[model samples]
Target: MKIHMLAAATLAMLAAAGVHAAPPEQAPHARVLQLDSNSDGVIDRTEAAASTRLAARFDALDANGDGRLQREELRGARKGHGPRGGHRGGHRHAGIDALARLDTDGDGRISRGELEAANAAREARAGADPKRAARTGHRARPDLLAQFDAIDRNRDSLLSRGELRSWSEAQRPQREAEMQRRFDERFSAADLNGDGRLSRVEVDEKMPRIASRFAWLDENGDGVLERNELRPQRGR
Candidate 1:
């Protein structure tokens, strides 16, 4: 009788553990590493120094050297440093791609007006259907709007070099938060009961990009992201 009681208690603990899972895999893709540009393996003072290098990265990726990022620059069609925009025959290479919906005009060109749009589009795209608005959740969180305001400090109706430069101080922190938020927001939306937990069914709905990125967030080994699973420390 004593042994059976102990076994039942252990099984119950395991059952609870099985309920609230963690982010699936491991660290995000080499996006952060590649951002270093210098190939330092670890992103040092350069990337975190400010919006300077980042702005320059954005500029360089702009291809035309325009102050803004555009859809054309993001298209898999353009000729870039590596192999022109995509995987051709299992090619091993590096590349860049920004949010296409930010091409406000549908013209595929991202002007200063489109930078924030790109970021927003990226958040939505992570767990969203490209055909629908990304904000389709049970209760709208002010996070999205707050994100816009943070980047659009001047509120002049557009993002500018001055604004982006001023924002470099927030670059690293924002990256940390944004990366995590992108993961939680996806799970939160699918958690219909608002129980702060997710099952495999909800987990299966994850988008390709989300699935590939931040698998490490699932630390609990469950199929969902629980409150405790978000305990990662954020920083520059």
Candidate 2:
């Protein structure tokens, strides 16, 4: 009787402590799938490469062959690049900060050479191991900064709606498809209410951190998000 009682007490204690557990790291099929994906932390290269084309196109517009571009070079890129009907005040610059600063050589014109250099640097780093993407306790590297600057359309430190729309429009179809796939995958789980749409309420309840993270990424203020938009915000 004593042995049986002791066993019962032990079971009770274990139950109270909730200690007989290795976490349910793998549960349902959907949960495991989400874990596999977010864990990889792979930035889609095809999408990144497609964005480079916009930089290239912008460089082509800077007639003087200098190595930096300004708002003037963005003649047809939404309001001549002056805010692009974008908002960049009260502690934020609408999505164009990097473009204004893309003058790698400080030549005041984003030339073909600058575009090539930026693209080369981006490709080199992107080709490295995913483990290296986030160096230990360090901030973004120069090449990453160059990548952001290369896409800043209004020459502002921030990206505006116009710039993002412009970039999306310029991307190759295949890259666009791949990026959209990743985006859909990332958001699929959190949309738990199963309404075939995402709501701020649902996102806040199921994925609050992602909701906060989305503010910087959703430059266009659209409900749907994209990786290109998120890339610039990774610094935040």
Candidate 3:
């Protein structure tokens, strides 16, 4: 997919810059090669078939839907990365949206006073329904206030889009690493046989989400998952 190409391009650029002496064994190129079972240089339907995760997005990544995903196609798919913004299809930036909603003056910014007012309004709404309030805590996330305090770099008690964006960018890498760590831990725990792979039954019990797409992840139709199959498609 585009993610794969982006990873390859990144590694290639690093190599050109002398930042990467040689491709690492754990690199995306290695993983892609492993996934490309037929040695055809492309991830064909049969190959990608083992990954429900890939299959779900396969059509989008394929571009031509010819039952194959070329390197170029994967690169093209990386054009507009990240979640879709705005109030449309996918509300990936829900926190940002919530902040915008709190801009009571419609001035495209949220001040501490505005945030307080929003919080109070939410509390009052919850008070009107005690049961619902109890269930949801009738408040925003526990860290919301702390996040705002940190983002308000100047201590002006106000937040701009730029500050929020900066904070998000700063947290991205750490968040991604943590997610990968969690996935690795889960995968390791699920490998009951210590065979370095997970069978369908094991995944069904330990990682239902993956079990749902077992057929797609078993690239060679082996009915088992290799470490490469379970790993994130995005290169390391």
TM-scores for every candidate against the unseen true structure: 0.27, 0.29, 0.47
- Please, what's the RMSD in Å of model 2? 16.6
**Looking at candidate 3, what is the lDDT of residue 201?**
82
> Which rank order by TM-score, best down to worst?
3, 2, 1
Full-model lDDT, candidate 2 = 0.42
Query: lDDT of all predictions, in order shown?
Result: 0.41, 0.42, 0.58
Tell me the tens digit of each residue's lDDT in model 1 across 1-236.
Answer: 99999999988998888855566754323333343333322222223222332222333333222222233333321233333223331111111233333447766433554565555555566446533332222112223234556656767655444444444434535544554464466456667778887555554463222233235656667667665553333222
lDDT of 2 by residue, 190-225 (tens): 567565555667656644445655555456887744
How much lDDT does candidate 1 score? 0.41
Off by over 4 Å in 2: 1-93, 128-187, 196-236
Question: lDDT (0-100) at residue 42 of candidate 3?
Answer: 59
Candidate 3: TM-score? 0.47
Clash pairs detected, candidate 3: 1-74, 2-74, 49-216, 50-216, 50-217, 50-218, 51-216, 51-217
Most TM-score-accurate candidate:
3
Root-mean-square deviation (CA) per prediction: 19.7, 16.6, 19.5
